[model samples]
Target: MAPRQKTAGLLDAVGPAFSRLRRSVLLDVENPVPAKDLTRTLVLNIVEDGADGEVTVGVVAERLAVDPSVASRMVTDCIGAGYLVRAASQRDGRRTVLRLSPEGAATLERFRQHQRVAFEYITRDWPEQERLEFARLLLKYVDAIDALRAPA
Candidate 1:
């Protein structure tokens, strides 16, 4: 086979493998806290990143590429699960902010630790140079994709 064909085959094999790997790493049910609801968990995580210790449902919906109502439902589910809190903004009564509670923060931290351990295990044998190169390549691809998706 030509070198081009070999590279194409390798890329083809990588696509499904990456999908399965991503799903296993991100949506594993055997996790200590488990992923009972991925959409809710993801929204809660976004809230955790806010400087105000919370994020608005509208912003989350924009980030998630979903409707405001869908994001509100996810927030409601997270609230019911005790993973998040919904509060009216002190400065803007009309807007609602979602926050991760103490319990929620702890759970999120544990999940991060699990993910770190998983990545560490997976890359344990990887050479430093190779890993650095992989990171650069991945970032390049990500940037290219983002550029394409940017509004004209």
Candidate 2:
């Protein structure tokens, strides 16, 4: 096949590949933590990233590429689930920021563990070097995307 076609095929597959991964139960196996949807995972992750700076609902919206109201509802859901807490920002007491509750941090860690397990299981048959390279490249790809979306 031509190089352009090969690249197009790869790009075309990415969406469905991500969609399937999102819907997969592999990440939820063993039930390490209380059941929460992907949205909560995303919100928790965003809050964790905020360890370097104050994170608000608006920040969540921007990070999630969602509307402010939508992010508000999602953040509220996270708070209700006890995974996040609303607190006064240290930089500006009048502004509210988000923090991960103790349970939230543990839950996120558990999720990461399960994700690693799932990835290992899925690629169990691949050559070890290939698996390691894929893991490194995938992390690099995701980190690059995150950096692009990061707040200015």
Which number leads on TM-score?
A: 2
TM per candidate comes to: 0.67, 0.85
Looking at model 2, report the run of 10 residues with the lowest lDDT sum.
Answer: 27-36
**Candidate 1: tens digits of C-alpha lDDT, residues 89-148:** 877888777778887887677777776666666666999888778778977997897678
lDDT of 2 by residue, 1-152 (tens): 99999999999999999898877756456554344555588899989988466999998998889999999999999899899998998889999999999988987887788788878788889999999999999999999997886669
Best by lDDT: 2
Candidate 1 — which residues are off by over 4 angstroms? 1-18, 26-33, 51-54, 132-152
TM-score of 2: 0.85
Model 1's lDDT to the true fold? 0.75
